[model samples]
Target: MNNIVEAKGLVKSYGDFKALNDIDLTIPSGAISGLIGPNGAGKTTALKSLIGLCDVEGELQVAGRDPRTSRHKLMEDVCFIADVGM
Candidate 1:
């Protein structure tokens, strides 16, 4: 089994507050995954970082390409949907 998404030592910060602290994650290919947490728990931050919607620290790989470096290319294969009425 190979990982379709991989994050190692992932960190996201806003000012002095850390939205995400050293997050390490791996999702196997063809696996269904979900992120569940309370408000301000870095769920959005993590998703944004994975899709290159925001700048992030540490390493992130999606489909064998770095999200930070190949965002345009990555976006070609990735889709994001948000609840506008939420």
Candidate 2:
């Protein structure tokens, strides 16, 4: 099975704070998955990085395209819905 989403050695930082540290993930096609964690656990950061909403280090690919370089094209195939606050 090929991965629909793949990340290796993923890292995301904000100034002096590290939101994500060395995250490695893979989601096979047609598989269901979810991310669960307490607040500030880097869950949001990871999602943001996957979709190219934030800058990230290491290798990341979604649907066979690099998120960092093909963000707009990637968006055509993927959709992201962040939490809404009132």
Candidate 2 residue lDDT tens string, 1-86: 99999999998888888898999999999999999999999998898888888889999999999988999999999978778631
- Candidates' C-alpha lDDT: 0.89, 0.90
Q: Mark the regions of model 1 whose C-alpha exceeds 4 Å error after superposition.
A: none
Per-residue error (Å), model 1, residue 11: 0.9
Which pairs of residues collide in candidate 1?
A: none
- The residue-level lDDT of candidate 1 at 1 comes to 93
Residue pairs in collision within model 2: none
lDDT of 1 by residue, 1-86 (tens): 98999999988899999999999999999998999999999998898888888788888999888988999998888877865521
For all candidates, the clash counts are: 0, 0
TM-score of each: 0.92, 0.92
